[model samples]
Target: MEVVNRYLETQASMCFSILYDRYAGKIFGKCLVLLKDEALAQDATQEIFTKIFLNLSGFGEKAKFSTWVYSITYNFCIDFLRRRKKMQSLFDDDTEVERLKDVADDVADEELMEMETAHLRAVLDRLPADDRTVLLMKYQDDMSIKDIASMLDKTESAIKMKLKRAKEKAYRFKQEMFTEAVL
Candidate 1:
């Protein structure tokens, strides 16, 4: 936070660069996991950083920097998906959904804990963007529930409920995949 404060005070490129260096990869990975498209993720990463850079002055020190950054990332990705869905509705048919079903059926999770990283990401991708965000924040970023509630602007109980539902959905998806594989 001292570095962040210095960056805010100095408006130095080096300070901003240091912040970017510390967070860009994690932000990009989160975008990729949520967007499920490398090209879109790359674009989204750039957009997220731009948001972070522009909004740095507004940061109130209420949450960890990483949590703040991730909140932006998650919000941007969800908005992007919503926009994409609206656009898709104008042109897309059921083929995309059918293709996703095929992909899901081909991937099985004997045990989620034992699943490979790629498989885990695939399963995560199958979840709703909000659910995926919760899981990522909890497990991938190891953020606490209180921090998540703050980031999401939700009550702690709401965050907990969301997390529980996300986990249950992931487990159900895994079981469905496993059953598909068996058949």
Candidate 2:
């Protein structure tokens, strides 16, 4: 924090570079999971870093720097998806179900389990950006509900509800996949 303050005060590129070195990988990982494309994630990571640098002066001390950075990352990715109109709902086509079924029938039990995990990932990707973000923040990043609420600027209860719904949605998708496999 002191270093960040100094960087803000001095406008030193080195300080900014240091910050980037410390956080770029984590930011890229978040972008990759949210964007679900390596190229898009890389581009998004660059854009996110730019936004963070430009907005450094506006950062309040209410949240940790990492939290603030992650908030920015999430907002950028969600807005990007919105602008592109690319948020597809899960199980939107019979072709996808057929594809999964075809793969499920040919695989051994171990491979089938792996495929199931992959299918769940695809389902997660298909969820609404906000829902995916909430799930990742809670489970992947292991964020506390309070911190998530603060980061999202929502009430704790609202965050809780969102998390619950996201989990339920994931479960439903998994069940649907399994049912499809069985049939």
Candidate 3:
């Protein structure tokens, strides 16, 4: 808050640099995971920082600064993928209602988090963009369901279901990859 206030009050370049130095790597890493291309991620990191600098005055303190930055990063990557793919929905919302009707058994978060890092990375790489993004927002970023729902512009219940589905997909992928490796 102090750093943000100082930056906003003085509009000093050094204050802004402090903010950039703190978040640039994290934002780039997230962009890489979602964009899945080095060149695109690099481009996105620069663009996202530009957006952040322009929108700094609008930061309302409703969420943590880190959360706010991450939401911006997530939105940018999602929009880029949507535009590039020309997809109707990144979250795959068309069948959401139908899928919600059937209450699939939940996958435990501990199970997913406890997997070996290499195996976990393999599983995440195989997931759809929507699934992988949701999982990273939840576990990797330690974001709450409410924060995620707000960021994604979905209801809390919808985010819960999405998280559940992503967890299941990740778990299944982990099993398949390791099983095939063993055979």
* C-alpha lDDT of all candidate models, in order: 0.77, 0.75, 0.85
Give lDDT tens digits, candidate 3, residues 42-158.
999999999998888899998899998999999998988898884457876756532332335777789999999888878887888898899999998999999899899899999
RMSD of 1: 6.7
What TM-score, computed on C-alpha atoms, does each candidate reach?
0.76, 0.70, 0.89
Ranking by TM-score: 3, 1, 2
- Residue pairs in clash, model 3: none
Evaluated against the true structure, the overall lDDT of model 1 is 0.77
RMSD of candidate 3 to true structure, Å: 3.0
Q: What lDDT tens digits, residue by residue, belong to model 2 across residues 1-183?
A: 877898989988889888999989999988988888999999999999999988998999888888888889987887788778775432122132212332223223233234465776777766666778887787666789998888777889888866765665565566676767888
Local accuracy of candidate 1 as per-residue lDDT tens digits, 1-183: 888899889999899889989999999999998888899888999999999988898999987888888889988887787788833432112233222333334222244557667667767978777778888888888889988877777889888767766666676677677657878
Scanning candidate 3 in windows of ten residues, the lowest lDDT window is: 94-103
- Give the best candidate by TM-score: 3
Ten contiguous residues minimizing lDDT sum, candidate 2:
90-99
Worst 10 residues of 1 by lDDT: 90-99
Candidate 1 colliding pairs: none
